[model samples]
Target: MPVFGLHIRILGVALAAFVVVAEVAYADPTPDFFVLLERAKAAPRISAGEAEVAAAEARALQAEVGPNPSLSLEVENFGGKGLYQGTDASETTLSIGQLLELGGKREARIAAASLEAQAVRAQQTRNTSDFAAELAVAYARAEASAELAKLTAEAVGLAEGDAKTTRALVDSGREAELRFVQASAELARVRAELVQARAAEASAFARLTAFAGSKTPFDSIAVSLLSREPRATAVAGGTAPAVAVAQAESRAASAKVTIEERRWIPDITITGGVRSFASTDETAVVAGLSIPLPLFDQNRGGSAAARSEALAASLRLERAQSEADADRRAALAGLAAASQFLSAQLEVERASAEAYRLAQVGYEAGRVPLLELASVRRSLIETRRQTINIRLARVAAEAEAARVTGRLPFGE
Candidate 1:
């Protein structure tokens, strides 16, 4: 009987230690930065990389202008029949000419390409900004989930302890069997919820790992980096998003119009050749000039098309500006609302602290049973979860605000 009593004491001590360890763990949840770092690694997709490459290509496009001059050599007279056949006689001639843009064609083409390159660069910036914003939001969500999971796990642990104590009381004729059953059911529910939370955390971490692609598990994130990258997102969200591209396309369209207008003039092609006959040993040189008469195709259609595109580009630029303004307003609203909610949530948490203390006192005095104590404890854990959510919401809202305002939270 003494040995059995000793075994019972050891078991009780182990259970008590387990509870203490769980509470300690819940008090401060470790961050999962490894998940977020993974997200950052794969943030920019292949499509965005292609956009950057296209911008680079546009810069290179400026080098591609009118075609280079063509050259050729011939000995025609010697290969000709009868009169033209002069195997021993020859005449050599050389001529060179280049096609130049008569109007502002070349200059316009270069300007348009340069503008297009700028627009592509802006697109790249926009993409990167979006990547950072997404990362911040996801990081907030994961933190919230982890904290909530820890809270829920603690609730389940408390509920399990209550179940064992209530079962013992019921066997001793102190508590009813029904009360023991109720406690068990509550413990099961909390356990189920904790399982679900763990699953959610895993999913969140998977996504974070995919994007950040880092080896470090999160102890904490630079709340500043995750807080908001205002300036960067704002630049992307600003008129710069599509402006460069629009300007480039517009310039290109204008260049096309200019090229078409130049067609109203004409092109002058000069050709020259020399001939020889071997039998008569005769040699002669001939030269001629050719020009096209624009009696019908005056490039009227091409010029009209070019003008229409430029007009379309102007409209698109205006639309992009309007969208950016709307986005900024929405982001600001989110940030303000989140801040307000976080403050209110903290007040609610203070109210719960007193309730928790009273409930614990009542339970020890035996005025309130284990079940009641478990209920109040669960409520406290849930309230803490609410606080975590509120903070996460604030973090997310701040990130969005940063995205819109184009300012980092470094100073503010």
Candidate 2:
């Protein structure tokens, strides 16, 4: 397939799972995390990376092509002494010469260029995976921020009601003025927190939008902040992009080494044409061959550099594989930890909500002080915020794990 066709196919597959933001048709009116990833793939950074891959492919195609033949015209002996002074005394020749590559140089050139293109493609794939992971994390943070803002609004409302009740009780001489002052202060503090929470939500949304390079406003996300645990069978197999890119570079370097070594075999140029002797009115066929001597400058330096580069590439490949393995193990452990932490936060939030509800009832019945009720309410809000944060953390960990293992949230 053509290079442009390959680029189009790659972009299509990357963006296929999600609809464009302007064209969203979901019944629930919520966008998935994959949708954010789709947008991210269209971001400037990703497009530029893919463009580099296409350029590399184009260069490889150029490398596969042979050199063009040269056409030559010669008027030998025309400017020489007595006998060659006139045009009739000169012999004119017209010929075409083609350079023939020896020692498999053409094949080596093609192989080197092709392998370099492959390496570029591998790096592009790795970049996409990393960008996708970043998008997922940003989306999670935005959604969690929204949730926290909502919870904060709820706390503000509850604090306002408590302040009003405390004020009424103080006016009726049923509660101390100091208690009412404390309640007013708590209400003011909660109101200020609500403002901060909203600002945080806006900041998160801005980050998500910028990262995805979308002009459309992201009001809400539909993806679950607490994703299900990844199964062992879902881990991606074969070499990941990091390892594959290194291996390709090694192979490409090896091909370059071969190309440099082939420099020892000089290129041959074969020429054929017709020569005309004007004075005798005679025309004859002429054929010639030319080859350079490799006595000096036989590309020894280039060969040594290529060989060293190949060795370095081989070592990098090994290191990349080792790092990928270590990253995979670490990501899996983090995912498990985040999952357990989210579950614990959920339980704590549920218990806090119940306690706050009971505290409100007891306060209304005069069995609980206004201070205690206010304390429970703050605890509940804090727990709710923590729960949202933990859920976001779990989703981020899941994304990172998938990225490290070369797995997609949706099957690749």
- Best candidate according to TM-score: 2
TM-score of 2: 0.88
Model 1 TM-score (2 dp)? 0.75
Worst 10 residues of 2 by lDDT: 21-30
TM-score per candidate, chains pooled: 0.75, 0.88
Residue 409, candidate 2: how far off, in angstroms? 3.4
| Model 1 weakest 10-residue run by lDDT | 224-233
Q: Which candidate leads in lDDT? A: 2
Candidate 1 lDDT over 73-180, as tens digits, reads 655446567655555444444544455445565666566566656556655655555565566667777666666777778877777777776777788888778888
- Each candidate: RMSD: 8.2, 11.2
Residue 78, candidate 2: alpha-carbon lDDT: 78
lDDT of 2 by residue, 1-412 (tens): 3434544544553343223322333223237766667656779989999999999999999998998999999987776678887686889999999999988999989988999999899888888888877777787788888788889899989998888878887898888998887886777676666666666666677677778887665656676544445443445465666887788888888888998888788899999999999889899999999999988888899889989988999999999999988887787788778778878888898999999889988876678999899889989988887877777777777777768766664334
